[model samples]
Target: MIEFSEVSIAYQGTPVLREVSLHIGEGELALAVGRTGSGKSTLLGAVNGLVPHFTGGRLVGRVTVAGRDTRTHRPRELAATVGVVGQDPVAGFVTDSVEEELAYGMEQLGVTAAAMRKRVEETMDLLGIAELRDRPLRALSGGQQQRVAIGAVLAAGPRVLVLDEPTSALDPGAAEEVLAAVTRLVHDLGITVLIAEHRLERVLQYADRVLTVHDGRVSAAEPAQAMRSAPIAPPVVALGRLAGWDPLPLSVRDARRRAPELRAELPGAPVPAPIEPGAETLTCRDVVVRYGGTVAVREVSLSVAAGETVALMGRNGSGKSSLLWALQGSGPRHSGAVTIRGTDPAGRKPVPRRMLAALVPQSPADLLYLQTVGEELATDRAGEILDELAPGIDPDSHPRDLSEGQRLALALAVQLAAEPAVLLLDEPTRGLDYPGKHRLTALVRAFPGAVLIATHDVEFAAETCDRAVVLADGEVVADGPTADVVTSSPLFAPQVAKILGGGWLTVGQVAGALR
Candidate 1:
């Protein structure tokens, strides 16, 4: 259904992908993997003619989708044949309400009104977003927006589906549902799906074939062979490699079957050393954030002392973001008292408030307005901090040209430049790799100020956070140590925790403790 023949893509004379020739059969689900800025997105964008066409790049060869050449047919011309859902769902939204967004694609294709309405309802039901039909697009959580984005394309009945980090923003359960829906489309409906994702642990098991984009070349192989030498890998695969297993395990269930013999080497459930937080503090009491009739955040009260890293854990729309924004003093706060070091940020100017408490929202792009990486990190110590957070990024590269992880690192560096008293990060791990995440943990761990991270990446929470807080329906449900909170919930538990089963939250913890 999709074919790339001698394809070489370059931007401004700099090659991104070189001589890539591959064919994906009808109904096959092919997963594309690579390091940040290694041409994974560029390759995926080429599937529907977004690379050289809309992106203003040079293409040397042909990209055919459903027998139509992408070199001649642009993204708009191939929209009905190839549906592309990018990393940022909100950026692609053209309609206000969820129902309209679902039907807008079909309307453009001139589908009959009766068929459009039926497809819209079917898609809403398929993705479990029926209740959000009338809700405005802007009000939906990042995960909700992602689902709507997929539904919008699915409603159009496209033959080929291209998803760029489809579940980056989704909660675990929601991710499973969405993936299940996609797999069903591939199996039951015979629709081809191509997914480019950094979070391989979520989709590897579901993929039939794996395509690794490395050093300007695309290597296609089975999941096992592809992961053998892949630069980035999930914790389970890392653990399998660490243990010298014959065939690497991709899923938790598979890892657990082989974990018993390995568990004997490590004799203890890790007891993390308690951190000594500083005296400076950030406290939010009775924080309530409401959007029209929706009470996004209830009367939630939380506190973070200086030198502390707290993970705000919850499902999508669980008020994790609402609480972060409220504490930042920019997002809506109907009634709340947020103070950092005895100073209320609500009364301060935007610039002054940033100095008090800086927030990197879910969409880190919102914090980035600069043209290049160098300009974004022009402030004192900003470039140094970025090197610490994520190294090897080119300062001359445009912010748009950077991968999701690279852009996120840039956005983080921009916020850290202010030297705020309290740092607020919402979904900070959306596009970070395992090594990059390690660097991020080191950076957050060494930061002198208090930090609150609103995230769904439990593995990251295990590594970086000193404490964890869970929110449900905009109210605090549980607050405790990272190991305790993450291990107690199966959905939130990391792969290592599921495999080793003795509070083993990470491969580092297990490897360090082993005989």
Candidate 2:
């Protein structure tokens, strides 16, 4: 029930979307796919009249949602017909508790108190957030916050829903839960859903239609037809293309049915050589971090050797983020000892923090404070550094104006310019497409130091890391080579491993074996 007719949008004489024409029928789940800074968000904003109205841009042509023209109606006026959930859930929160946040949208729409209460509970049960009714919004984990955000929008009872990178910060299981709930909404309630996501593997299975945005142009087609030539696709689709499978499979179950012949073609494929870690660069002993009565991290001891890349993977709220912060020496540690190059990071030494380690948190905007990319680069003398890390970013664009992937690249460039001995990144591929993720993999491989990354991206870990350290309930449960850890665990295995039933972790490896 969303329509865009001859829509061309520009900001300060720069074109973002050009003459885009498309229609999304009611009850259809449409997926938007593209690279970073490719106008996905801009198109989503135009649905609720936020592009030219709140964002201060120039809009030409028309955008209508549920037969209401967005050009004539403001976002508030169209609130009853459309609901939007952005990338950052914390930024959109206006209340303190989960129950309150869910009810806030209904109250804003001037619904009766009884109706608001009923919808809040129904939405909570629908999204499986009933246990977190009284929890504070700020204290919840990223995945829990995401559930609350979606529940809030669904409680509004709108005809259409627009979500931007809805599951970027969630673990595999949690992502499945969120997508299942959205699918139920489209099928059970006939509510149209439009999602812009980079992790196509997780959401493509549930989408009825696909929309591809590339080089400022938008095209729509059936999911199978669109994925055949789409610029970005999941690993299973890539594998199907490489093996010449007809009617490419979108899920692991379908791929496995057709994988036997391909598996027999390449009998004994060789695994890539693993990286050998050098001398110890970082060490921690009995690290414990607590928040009031809750122990986020228990007595955990870990070490990272020089020239090693270790991926710290676990479910949501599994203490991965807490452990990373504790090791950084900037966050709270109730009782622990962390040493960097044989020196305590929290000691009275004169060395700067940047020299020891640099952390890129989940929210990259927290580390960016400058107005524009040009000024931030000038402050750190990182013009050449950013170019080497992630090129083709506009210097005059505001840091907030950049897309999620571009913002992440800028934050990484700013941190890598310091040349730290150790690097820590949390959910680095949150909004990055395949190309952006490839560039990040290359950059991480080229870094000359020990690196520890806390992430839920299984594909990325398989492609870049040499080792995997998995934590559960604030304790280390599994730690070994990447292949051994990922292949042995069902929850953390990549698509290729699930389909081929071997140790194949990526499509590139299968292609190598066939060649």
Candidate 3:
């Protein structure tokens, strides 16, 4: 369905994808896994002629998708043969209503009204998004928006679908729904699917073949079953290898088949009960927040106790970010009150004490403006903070010049400069590499402050935090120990849930049996 022959692309005279060659067969599901800026998105763009045509890149070699040569085909011409869903769903939305959003693509294709209506209904049912047909596009959650976007494309009946991080912003439940819909589209409808994703654990099982890309080159392309023991395996895949299972299973049910044998090989230990409550550090009492005329957060009550780490989870626009900012006293919260260690941290008082509640914003760039990473840390504190958080990062290197992961570490080091007792981090691992994410997780776990992380990375929350809370529709729907809460809540359960019989979240715990 798609073929790349010695293909290379450069943006603004700078090379991105170099001599990439691969073939995606018809009605096959292929996953492109790679770290950020490794040219994964560039490869996807090449499918629909977006790389050279829209991104102003120099394209070399031959590229074809759905029997059309990409070198000659423009994005508009390829739209009928190929449907591309980008990383951000909101970026692709062109209408206010869900029905209109789905029909927009068909209208552009000049399909008759009867055919468009029939296709819209069929696609909506296939994606199980019929209930969202009447909702305003702006008011819908990110996951809902993503589903609608996929439905819109499916309605067009394209031969091939290219999705870039479709579930990156979705919750575990929503991601599953999207994946299930894609599976149906591939198996039932016989559509060719190519997906680029960072969350490999969720999609690896569904993928017919796995293509691992590193530094703009294909490192490995093999059957998913044969690639189970690769060093860079997901937690459960590694666990399956360690558990001595032959023909390692990709999904949880497959792993469960070996559960009895796994149990026999282990020395059973008592699973600890959920921890008791501690002294309140940052407490929110019936908080209400509004934007313009619409309420963003209702009477939501939650607390981050002293010396504890809590994870806030929900769909996008589900008030996770709003609640995090509200704790800092800068958000739209008005009715409810929040107190930090017996006093409102939001109140104007001593600078030193107020700085105790440090907030790490969603974007690291917001906190990074220093000419040199070293100078940034040095300018903030005399020497002690720099010595602790930034042990080896050059104190004089420019922050903007560093890699995404490096910049994240540098930003985090600066956030820790205040030595805040209550640290608030929002999606700290969004663009980080595996190693960078591991380092950040360790940093968060080692910190002594009361930490509240607002994130969608369930695995990270399970590994770093002791407690987890689910915030949906601006209210705390569930709260308890991280493992227990995640395992119990359907909304929060991730691929890791299938492996951790008692709901374990970390890769380390999965490795314990191997040791």
Candidate 4:
């Protein structure tokens, strides 16, 4: 009941989506998958008329949703027919309390006060956020705020739901909750859902059909089966097909149907044998960090032995990033101490010396500021890009002009210039596509140093890390083998485990067993 006909949109005089025509049937769940900057967000905006109307784009063709012409309707009017939950929910927040946040949307539609209250309560219950009704929007965690945003839109009872990377900012556990809730709304309540996500494996099973968008055009639209066989299938999908499973598994349960053989052949899985222990390298002892009124991290201690790779896992706002910052001497630490090679991080003379630590932030470009990529590398150390450990990225071009993968490579090359003994990566795979992630992971594995990574990509952690640390509410909750924590623990278990079965933590492991 939602359609786009010969649609073309340009932002700030630049074309983002061109001649894209598609339709979403009533109650059908469809997934729009593409690489970064592929116009997936632009496609979702057209359904709600946020395109040429609100976003200041030049619209070429007609768009309609739920029998309403998008060109003729404003975002407020379209909200009654379509619900939207964006990637950063906090950016859309206007109210303080959860209850008011839900009511605000309906209130804008001029819904009767009594009906608004009833709808708000119903939505909170449906999304399992009833207990958070009184919590202030600022006080809620990233996941809680996102759920509240969904509930706010659902309260309006739209016929169609359009979400743009709704789970991109959420942790694994919170992401699962949001996805499950979306599926329930579609299967049991008959709501049409269209979602654009980079994590294809997580939402592949829920899709009635999969559409691939590339370079601002609809590249492929087919049944899930056809999409699975396409040359550009997600890593897990390709691995499932290679394993000879009949009709290849989409979700974990389907993969588990063959778990008997899968488990029996565990010996054949090509997991790297445990390496010999190395000497102590980077260590954090009783670290405590507070942010004004709240203690974000407290007395959290961890260590990364020489040649060891450790992963930090947790829900968003669980103090994972805070702990990383404290270790890197970027965030404020209230009490306790951190020792890297017997050198405290809080000291003023900790730069590129006895305890050198390089932190690769969530956005690699955040640390990049040179005119040319070669100059960016030169800024840190001459000929640094030629290091055998660095990825092959063009050196002559501007850093901002490179692709996400290339930019990530350049960031690493610069960080390695100092030849730091310790590396700290925070969300290294945030915006990467399937291939980009694999390439970056390879680079991480090849680096010669102790590494500590904090990420939501649990599969990556399982593939790269030997030890895992799970943090929640400013405290270390669990720490042990990466496989044990990711596959068995409640906090670190990823969607891959929930979808593909327990033992297959990484795509390589899953593919190896299948072969």
Candidate 5:
């Protein structure tokens, strides 16, 4: 259903994809895997004519989808056959409510009203989003917005779907829902699907074929064959490699079946010493954050000590983001108080807010407005800070031109320039690869003050956080050591913990015990 013939693409003379050739069959789900800025997005864009046509790049050779040449057809012309959902769902929204968003695509295609309504309901039910039909798009959580975006495209009844990091913002359960829906489309409907995701573990099990994009080239193979040497892999694959397991396991269940021998080989190891948390650096007492009549955060109390890293994890719309905003003194706090370094942030005057805390919102791009990276770094006289946080980024490149990971690094550099006592990051690893996530982990470890991160990435939290705090329905559900909190919950457990079942939270911990 999709074919790329000697496709070489460039942007302003710089080649992004070079002589790539691949074919995706009808009813096949192909996964694109690669490190950050490794042409994954560029390759996906070529499928629907977004690369050279809408993105102002040069395309050589041919890309055909459903027997139509992308070179000869614009994105709008191919919309009936190819549906594309980008990484940022909110940016693609064109309607006020979920139902309207789903109908808007069919309306553009001039689909009959009766047909549109039928497809809308079917798409909503398919994705398990029927309950959110009337909710305004603006009030939905990041995960909800992502689901609506997918539903909008599915309602159009396209022959092929191209999704870019479709499950990045979703929690484990919600991600499973989205992936199940995609699997149903590929099997039950015979629709071709192409997905690019950084969290390989979540999607690899659902993919029939894997496409690895690296060094301006693309290669196709089955998941097992591709993962053997793929630069980006999930923790289960990494564990299999480290333990010398043959035919590396792709899912947690497979890994668990092979875990007994490895567990017996390695002796019980002591848990590493926890970080010595210093005196209270930030404290929240009965923080009640509400929006109109909706209680987003309900009388939640928490505290973070100096030199501590705490992860705030929960389901989508569990008030994790709301609590973070309230603690930053930027969002509504119907009741309760927040104090940073013994001074209430809402009442402080002499000391600047930046000095007290710095928050990197879920959408890092929203905090950036400058034309170039150099201009963004110059705002706070942050030459030294940029050099420290992100050393290799080109200062002259446009911020929009950078990759998702690079953009996130730039945002971190800009925020860290303040040298605040408390640092808050919301979904910091959304688009980062393993290496990028490691670098972020190192940066977080180097910070001297307290840190609070709100994320759904269990592996990232297991690697970097010292403690875990879970919220449900706007209330704290669990708060304890990171290993204990994550390993005890099936929904939040990392692959290593799920497989080994010995309170191990990450591969690093297991490797250390083996050594």
Candidate 6:
């Protein structure tokens, strides 16, 4: 249903994709895998003519979707044949309620009122979102919002559906909900699906084919074959490689079945030297946050010591973000006492509060606005910090022009330069690859102050954080050492822990003992 013939695309005189010839059959779920900023989005954009038509790039070859050449057809012209969903579902929303948002797409295509109503209901039912029809779009959970976004496009009855980073912001259970819906579309409806995701563990099992894009080249293979040498891989694949298993396993269950001999080789998951947390640097008491009638955060009390890192984790709507915002002192807090070294940051001025605690938000654009990376890091020895975190970034390049991973690094540099007593990061691994994540882990470990990370990435948390705190219904549910909290729960455990069934939470830990 989709074909690319010797397609070469360039933006600003730099080649993004070169000589890419591929075909995706109807009803096939094809996954595109690559490191950060490796032209994965460019390939997806070319499907419906977003690459050259809207991005103003040079296209040297032809891309045809459902036998319609993208050269002559713009996105609007091809809307009937193709539906595209972006990384942020909230950014693409045009209506306030779920039902209205679903119908808006059909209205633009001039679909009849009767057919629009029929398809809207059908799409919601198919996505298992029938109960959310009246919910406001902003109030929905991350997974629910993603489903509404998918249902909105599916109502148009397009032959091809494309998703970019569909579950980057969702927790484990929520990510499963979104992927389950996508797999149904391919199996029950025979819709051609093309998805680009950094979290391969969530989508690899559902994919029929995998397209590995690296350095402007695209190679097609089955999931098992593609993961053998893919540049970026999930923790399961890394464990398989470390053990020298023939034919890498894609899922935790498969890996566990093949891991008996390897298990015998290791003593119980090795225990590392305990880190001594310093005196308390951050403390919160009876924190309460509300959004009108809904209570987002309950009376939560927590404390973080100097030279310590804590992971704040929960479901998509379980008040993880709300708690982080309240502690930052800039967001809403109906009642709370947040102190850093005996100083109430909430009572200080904006500049003073920033000095007391620095927050690196989930979205990179929220932190970077200056024209160049050099100007943004022109204070507090941030250039030295960036050199240690991610070296060789062009100082003069536009902050917005950098790749997702590089932009995150630039933002981290800006925050680390402040030398605050407390540091908070929300979803820091959204666009980072394995190497980028390791770099971040190293930086977090070496910092002298306290750190709290609000994230959904279990593996990254295991690698970086010494403690884990879980929230449910806007209240703390689980709090303990990272290994104990993650390994004790199936939903929150990392791949290695799931496979080995012990204190192991990352491939690095297993590799260190086994190798």
- Best lDDT among the predictions, by candidate number: 6
For every model shown, the clashing-pair count is 0, 0, 1, 2, 0, 0
Angstrom error at residue 114, model 3:
4.1
Candidate 2: stretches off by over 4 Å: 347-351, 379-381
lDDT of each: 0.88, 0.89, 0.75, 0.76, 0.89, 0.90
Where is model 6 more than 4 Å wrong at Cα? Answer: 387-392
Judged by whole-model lDDT over C-alpha atoms, candidate 5 comes out at: 0.89
lDDT of 4 by residue, 1-515 (tens): 98888888886566778897888899999888776556777788888988767767699888989889988998877888999987668878998899999999888889998998889888988889999989989988877888888888899989999988777667877888988899989998899999988777667877887777776777545545655545345545654665666677776667667656656655643555576647788888788888888989979987788778888888888888888878887678888777777776665464644236888776688889989877877754534543333344457767775554456667877776777778888877665666666666666666677889988877667777888898888899889888778878654665445545545566666555655
Error of 6 at 412 (Å): 1.4
Q: Identify the runs in model 5 with alpha carbons over 4 angstroms from their true place.
A: 139-142, 347-351, 379-391
lDDT of 1 by residue, 1-515 (tens): 99999999988898889999999999999999887768888998899988888898899989899899998898989999999998878989999999999999999999999999899988888778999999999988767788889899989999999999988888887788778888988998899999998888899999889999888999898898888899888888999999998699988888889998998887867879778999858998999999899898989998899999999989988989889888888888999788888988886899899999999887777777888889889886889888887787889988877888888888888889899999999898887777788888988988899999998888889889989999999999999888889989999998898888888888888878864
**Native-to-model Cα distance after best TM-score fit, residue 206 in candidate 6, in Å:** 1.5
Off by over 4 Å in 3: 11-15, 223-226, 229-231, 270-280, 291-298, 305-307, 314-318, 341-419, 431-433, 490-497, 500-505
* TM-score of each model, paired residue for residue: 0.95, 0.97, 0.84, 0.83, 0.96, 0.97
Which residue pairs collide in model 6, if any?
none
**What C-alpha lDDT, on a 0 to 100 scale, does residue 154 get in candidate 4?**
90
Give candidate 2's error at residue 27 in angstroms. Answer: 0.5
Error of 5 at 151 (Å): 1.9
lDDT of 5 by residue, 325-392 (tens): 88887778889989999877775442487689888888888778999999998765466655554566
Model 3 / residue 376 / CA error / Å: 9.0
Model 6 agreement with the true structure over 54-149: per-residue lDDT tens digits: 888799989999999999999999998899999889999999999999999999999999999999989989999999999999999999999999
Candidate 4, residue 417: how far the Cα is off, in Å:
6.1
Using alpha carbons, what is the TM-score of model 2? 0.97
Model 5: pairs clashing at backbone N, Cα or C within 3 Å:
none
Model 1: lowest-lDDT 10 consecutive positions = 361-370
Expressed as tens digits, the lDDT of each residue in 1-515 for candidate 3 is 99999987875666777788888898999988776556777788889998788867699999998679987889999888899998668878999899999999999999999999999999888888899899999888777888898888878889999998888777777788889989999999889999988776678889888777666666446644545634356656666767767777777778777776665655453254455546777888898888887777888887776668888888777788888777876666778898877767665454654466777776677778768766777655524443443344456656764544456566777767677778998877665545556667777766776889988887777777888888777778888878778777655665545654655455466557446
Among all windows of 10 consecutive residues in model 2, the one with the lowest summed lDDT is 345-354
